[model samples]
Target: MSAINKVLFIAPRFHTNQIGIVKALLNEGVEVEFHVLIKGPTEDYAVLTPIKIEEGKFSRFLSKFLKTQKVNKYYAFPSFFEYFNTIKNFNADLIIIRDPGRFFSIVSTIIAKLLGIKICFYTQETLEIEAKNTFRYFFQKFYKTIFHAEWITPIGGTDTRIKKFLPFVVESRFDYLNETSAIEGYSSEKAVAVIGKFTARKRLIWALKLAQEFDCKIKIIGENTTKEHATVYQELLEYVEEHNLGDNVEFMCNLSHSRTLKELSCSNFFLLTARNEPASISVLESLSVGIPVICPLECGTSSYLTPEKTGYTYRQDDYDDLKNKFRRLLVHVSEDKKIRVECLNSSAENFSEQAYINKFNYIFKRE
Candidate 1:
């Protein structure tokens, strides 16, 4: 079990980022299995989702009974026996438990511990973002203290609450593009691109407002997967009609990962208005394609942002600040031709497949 040859990831929903992770592991000759309980139709999927797992009636009922709406979309967990058997049969050298705050991760933690398996807690959460989730944040605290993993690896969280951190690595499909194509894809146009889940937290409405005010073309892409999010999506559509923004703004949904990036690649820049976004894979995806990003402060992926070089960061939830920074970024991009090169360099040094494999080695070395 001390070896790092095999790995298991148990996540609530399947994200395109996981495909990158799985491929990176496989390239290193590590056997991997991703047990997905939910296939989020709106997760900006690149390809078809994998692993069509079978869930019995009782397990599905219990999972739904304990579901929390705040996690976004519905998800289920396999029965204890199935989860236990999967871990036992895989007998992986390393178990990367993501969303340590979720019920599925909690159950997996206890089972992994009972079987004496080694685990490395992988999270995109900073404590500040966790606190936003309230009760689940508390559950994360309890889980950390009680269930004890050998290591805690986070994706670009600088929160001091965690004593030590081995950075979690991630990349996008765009990373494979040649430098010429990557640079060529960034258009001279003024259109701003926004992509992610169509939730209030993602601030699609705010992105629309900015687009309308600037009188710029906007490509808004994401899925409205839940009833709660659907309301927000409707509001976006209504705003487009009411403000006569139909000509300026375009709405898209259920786009494959490549298609999303392709759409974004042609934009002047990428805009993310979310607050407390814990290490946005979306941000890195934009950077990978040589598109500069405009995100809020505390966006974990902003670690790659170098003031006026790659992109810029605004104060979270501050629309005024966002407007001000957006103006500054546009002005700077017009003057700075080096943004594209800088963006690609940042993506390669931070979230490339090489980076993922390098950070992965640290989990085994953790004391």
Candidate 2:
């Protein structure tokens, strides 16, 4: 077998999917190193080790500006230096970067090309015509530059939309099927669970409102990131208090990934109300635990969620639709043990981690 000695992964944040990919590559005997442009402590991976590039206050301020501008040009100088230094030091064979949406990726791609390193771009969002602009022009140019040598891998339900713009080397869903075995039986509960960052776009207030109306408990697990997030959380808290839902709605902040998974295992159901999402790992993780997921049809994961079989998908931003769906799920809660088992079985077959790895290997070996 041809050897894949070293790989450098650049990403915005660490998630289970990213860790899973690194773990798989390590199992295949690849030396993996990660470079995070933004700094945050992450879950430790047994297969891969991560190295962070220390940033000065000036550079950090500039990065924030560039991120807001959607122009990655500011990161070029520092990223080029870091990439060149790392390539020379590590003698890496493959350089993998996630999401061409950032300026760091553009810089990394250029440096990799100059050093004769193989390049791979892992995309999460659909590169549709709607993204056309100065920023997208540069993104498309980079896409053309890396067209031949490496691979283009996208994870989620927007494959049809993405293929319309760029040639996809491979496609994989966000779920890891290997871990989810088809388990029988489920426990009933009076409350629902919502997980993810506490942001306005997530429409978490909607879930809170539903919980209040039905006199059911709503456990919200996530952190408030920005002022907008603080405001949203505050408003929700006030609403809960005003509507006398203090006992029914509980807020838990920033549980680690593994702990979150453990929490999902016991929840009656999962709720997601994102205004937009390419794919949500939370939904997949919930499904893996055999918890029925209730989300909007526009969410990427909705494509895989078969109503009455797997879970439910309601109309976007339609409170009536959401209320009705919640009611249906509540009514069927007593009868969902068999349904949950079927959902788990079906999800296990479709979203296995081994399947994802096989698809990745095929893309990596493409001529």
Candidate 3:
């Protein structure tokens, strides 16, 4: 329904997630082009970085003032003209910008406004009602007014109260999982799966506690925490030894994507132990495989979870609450056979590649 013909997306970095959107646009007869400002770990994808800013003390200082983690990112004033020309030559009907509050975003907004091009911003920032009276609030209002740019978020900024602060809202998520075969072989003997590195921030030890208290099996799948690895890895091993959870817990490392899905196929249920995860893709991957997810309330994708249907959510700060929710999910995993199908339906409905494409088109349609 969106009158999309030709569009340009500007971002600081591009990842695999953008592939679905591009393919969808192409399929819809909408010409699409992307321009990024940073390089990923590899050169496997086709991307154009019009400007490169050298990382230095000055860049880091500006990033601190902006409260941004991208310390290496800055405005390459010298390349402004060249970047402007590239964007102008694209001749896009609408421009989409991600990574708001960065120098690159501001510069692109200014250029797009000058060229009289319609603009949209994509963000992951959560809506905070308490900050309404702050200077940041007024600054945001000014920015939105001056640039005439509407904000779109894949996570957060969806609450009706916050819509008054933001010009408009799209209460949806854009998470896309690759084609998945739902795991129909969930077994009683299978362990509850937790996926992530053995990092302290991930709070994987909680999964261990579930195994210890409930006499259940646990599968910890991710990179790191092998026999001889970092301290956190050793710490996990030490806990396994001290609690005699060696048999109760299993560790897998450096698995291929297909292999990981295969492991998930047999899991009793999936548990996301990380706190304040903006939006963990593991939850989507788990849902895709037809396993219920137990994730923290602070996770952005927690919005997708419908209790007793998809999965249950608990507060990240409350350890007891997680145990309670997992305990409840554990019961359903054994007593209910229909949850797998429901989880699969939820994945296809919300997080599949097609679903993401539809959401993108809807955002434009609603425009």
Using TM-score as the measure, which candidate wins?
Answer: 1
lDDT of 2 by residue, 203-316 (tens): 888887888778788899877666876888888888888988888888887677777766676677788878777667677777766777888877756656777777888888
Candidate 1's residue-wise lDDT over 48-108, tens digit each? 2455445546766776576575663234455778768877998977777776656667677
Residue 9's lDDT in candidate 1: 80
lDDT of each: 0.70, 0.65, 0.67
Stretches of model 1 off by over 4 angstroms after superposition: 42-68, 72-77, 127-148, 157-190, 225-230
Residue 147 of model 2: what lDDT? Answer: 51
Candidate 1, poorest ten consecutive residues by summed lDDT: 155-164
TM-score of each: 0.83, 0.80, 0.77
Q: How far is candidate 3 from the true structure (C-alpha RMSD, Å)?
A: 5.5
Ordered by lDDT, highest first, the candidates read 1, 3, 2
TM-score (C-alpha, index-matched) for candidate 3 = 0.77
Q: What residue pairs clash in candidate 1, if any at all?
A: 45-257, 46-257
